[model samples]
Target chain A: MFQPSMQNIYRYFIISLLITVAVNFSAAQNKTAGSDKSSEVKWWNGFLVKMDVVSPVVTGFSDSEHFGMEGSVQFNLKRKIFPVYEIGFGGADKLSSNAIRFNTNGVFQRIGVDFGLLKQSNDKELINNMLTGGVRLGWSNFSYDLTNLSLSDDYWGGSQTLNFEGRSTTKTWYEIVVGIQVQVYKNLYMGWNIRNRHFFKEDTSGNIVPWYIPGYGKSGSSNTGFNYTIGYHF
Target chain B: MKRESGNNDYFNFKNLFNILKNFLHNNFIKSTVFIWITAVFFFSTSCIVSDEVCRKEKNSRLKVGFYTAILNSSTGNYTLSTLSIDSLTVNGVDSLGNIMDSVLYNNSKNLSSIKLPLNKFSNESKFIIRFNDSIQDTLTVFHTNYDQYLSFECGIIRNHLIDTVLITNHFVDSVKIQEHNVSTIDAEHLQIFHN
Candidate 1:
């Protein structure tokens, strides 16, 4: 009886120790590798550069567009504040139901700052993730082509078919963005953001409004946008 | 942790309420009320505005004026003089060789000018016009149809350009083409001269 009791205690002790070790190993691997780096890093740390892989992939499946690409670079400040710069190019060759043709290709840019919203505490587990809110100022300059447009004078005896080519304009807009980034691998992150964009002015001239704006989805006074990005940290 | 007190803070809810009360008591409320009023403004706009009340006829029709050719003694040329028909009737034909309805001006008396609509689907418009129940003429217009997109609200409109006008001469002597294009604007298109 004494020998059996001693074996049971020994077995229970080994099992508890193994369970503790396994739990600790997973927790450490899933969380940040080191907690000291997050607090010790001063402002003006290395930059985190990201590329938007979703935009190009989505444009490939777009019916109206030929292709599109977007990328961004952000500077980390105390791991709490970030200044971001984004650039993109998009174009579309679309034909309307009435045989009105619209073609355009343009470059767009956005500048913004993001604020980190993750709660900070001394005793919590170290997780390299962030919830961010940001505001952006965006602009695009482009030239477009409109063809096969017909105009007639009803009482007059003449009709004209007109084509407008290389009509250029500059558009300015603003966006409010919210997003989340999670560290998937060591020094690598995957993130997505939703943005609400509003344009300050619209081109409502005699000509038809542009069917598509470079960074904005459609040519409207307001729009919503989404981006999925993969990033690397230095 | 001690800074979370409710009464001693400038950013507290009480302070915000007081600030809003003060703002409402000032002229700033005028602009706010104006914005609210405009926010409630409603417009009955649509993608297509149906033809409702008949104010003025559509300008898509061709206008014709009747005239009599008089022998000029000085230039030895026939000049046009305005003439009115005793009784006039016009009918339009459709694609299935069916006589569509008689146009707006049917069995009219003493008409100086007549308006006729062209075919919307086909390139040719055929019309049978009778004058005084004794003289009848068939007018055929060959043209091209152009679909014009005015705007989203206005929708699409069909415009036509006349290539040629052929008519069977009964009591009519000659025909003159004044305008070759027909649209929503009103203008004289052709003049028919009587013998």
Candidate 2:
């Protein structure tokens, strides 16, 4: 049923090709410029603590059906590899158009590692800038409530109202992330990233699946999310 | 020309820092931030709320088709063929022989199959079938009903499993069960064989 036009495919291909060429060129330049200075950075170059500023603002601007806030601590290794630990809390109070209401709130955690694509420079001005790609494994455990659910027998001439409360579930998912971070001021950094997230398991039939999973957006197989973060470097 | 490389590095870092400070103060960074904010705003507002309605059939009914047995000459075996009735009237009844108010088929002409709703509250459903308004037969179905949760939008529906069938031998010869499991999905569950 879904068909991609040749023009669109060509356009996407061209864009991706351009991006690849640009990144390769930049990395090549950095490689030549920082070949001798790369050893100056230490293996453990401290850590950065960041807080997401996009989720709260975006959810507030939207219908407010969902809201989430998250923070992360990423340890820098030789200004190249980053091992990160992130935690967040998310909640939703959504009422469907048909009067079915769902409510939930819980905490979620993620552990991951990122690889910097840009070679490190000894120059302090360029030392705090990075182009990074990473993968994350996230887990959450939460309970939800669904109310005002009704079933009607039109032919048999009867209707029954059903409600499920305190139904708990555990969910695990993975994310592929790409982002850029730059030092805006002394010891202060600003960055943004886009994530493509996918769940490890699907909801089985006849199960009362939650309308929204904490930190995972809507209840579905995959979701795309964006985050803009501000961090302080130690 | 022969200065220390460390001093050259420090001078270059200072110059680069000043250039970065000037770039941050320029309108370029401000414009980029504005574009990023606009993009985020659009992305946040673009989420379309799902308006999915319950599209699956929720009614659980028993499907009965009329058939006639014909003998195959070469194989000497009886083969079943579909039979259409001229006129048929079907309605449910209680155990006391009192007909319910609902009529499933009211003089349906040239009907080969009919669907009847089973009772969710009772274990047995009785239906009176009047053929051509002249001959009548009573068909009884014994089934067990269970609840199945479909989804939040569709809620729940009662499904049935057929155990046995009892019918009066008036104008109907014999009855056969084709399929036993009955839910919202439409399928032929019973067959009525007549001459």
Candidate 3:
């Protein structure tokens, strides 16, 4: 019989389940405070709240094999340039080799700018429509748990091979996310974003070939797996 | 009574050892085949159950009756498996590098439609499929079988980049038989969890 690792699988299942429940509950509870904006402020100066859910096209082992949550709030400092803070989770599916499930995923918190496309109108004929684009740079702690993965060769292929059935943690991960949003209603809007996550630094052949870092169209490029969420302005 | 019981235990151990030896020598691939059969059977079972959704007979081997690319262009129609000392054609290699000849392949078929056979494999063993060095040495494909799944693992090893693997099935059209990176995975990590 094969060596069964049922215990570890069960533990992983529980962890994933808990995270799913927590995120869903958090979104529901913050609906009022983060859903729609009240009509108390002027068009030029207002706060916008946004929340989104992400389901990946490629996942499992290579990435966190589950749908994750991410949301943010931005209090418009001005009409042209608005500074905002955001936080969320991300996972990678592409790999350089099969030996390692080259996964780099974690939570991120960033502060960036949101540029509005159209000028705020004084007329109320249409519910205020606007176009927005933004970029954010944040820090993330990437952790790879190898406890459930194993690599063996022969009868003597012992634990010296750095089997993945062990868990590992790697912090100091940085990612950049840029996206565009279109506001159709007063505060309700539709938006899409692409996030790029790199290992921050690469250490290959002692020359540091950017193993921990990623480039354009290079490794760890999150193409188009973002979500569409409804936002309300306050 | 104790002596008799000890003798019985001794014989039981001897019998188990003999059975194991036989399994290793004659049925060398017994474990491997069992795992492979189970994986094939499982995916086949799922397709069978999902018949009401999309009606199709339970195909033991996915028919590649129609293939688009025949000329790999770079590698002259033939390559060698560096790890296993076998000649692997463009389609896929087996335990021995002989171009996988299938019962479905028709000699009279044109090159355009000359589809390779199904990559029949099991979980009892893992296979490494090496490509001709002419194209690029950055890619390596792996085959690993399990009780309920047959995974094809592929990865690119770049000198100045982060490495990654894609573990999935042969059918590139559907999202069902998905693949993942297996390097960092151990025996403990495989699971089917709920949302």
The candidate maximizing lDDT is: 2
Q: Of the pair 1 and 2, which is ahead by lDDT?
A: 2
The CAPRI category of model 2 is incorrect
Point to the candidate with the largest DockQ: 2
* Candidate number that wins on DockQ, 1 or 2: 2
Ranking by DockQ: 2, 3, 1
| lDDT (Cα, tens digit) per residue for candidate 1, span A138-203 | 999998887766555432234566677888978899987766676678889877775667888766
**Residue lDDT tens for model 2, B1-195:** 556888798567556644653464343347457646754663554355353587777888899999999999999999989999999999888767789887889999999999998877678889999999999999999999787766656766788899999989899999999999888778999999998
Q: Residues A145-212, candidate 3: write the lDDT tens digits.
A: 32112333222122222223223343333433334455666567655554434445542321111122
Model 1 chain B weakest lDDT span, ten residues long: B39-48
Instruction: Give per-residue CA lDDT, model 2, range A1-234, as digits (tens).
Output: 857743354346345534543554555566668676556668998899999998898678757788899999999998888999999999899876568888999999999988775444456676777767778999999999988877665555567777889998899999867676878999899988766678988878666788888878887766767888999999
In terms of TM-score, the best-performing candidate is 2
Candidate 2 regions exceeding 4 Å error are A4-41, A62-64, A119-123, B1-46, B94-97
- Cα lDDT of candidate 2 equals 0.79
Kindly list the per-residue Cα lDDT of model 1 for residues B36-62, writing each as its tens digit: 343223111111223323343334788
TM-score of each: 0.49, 0.79, 0.35
Docking quality tier of model 3:
incorrect
Runs in model 1 deviating more than 4 A are A1-41, A64-66, A121-127, A152-159, B1-195
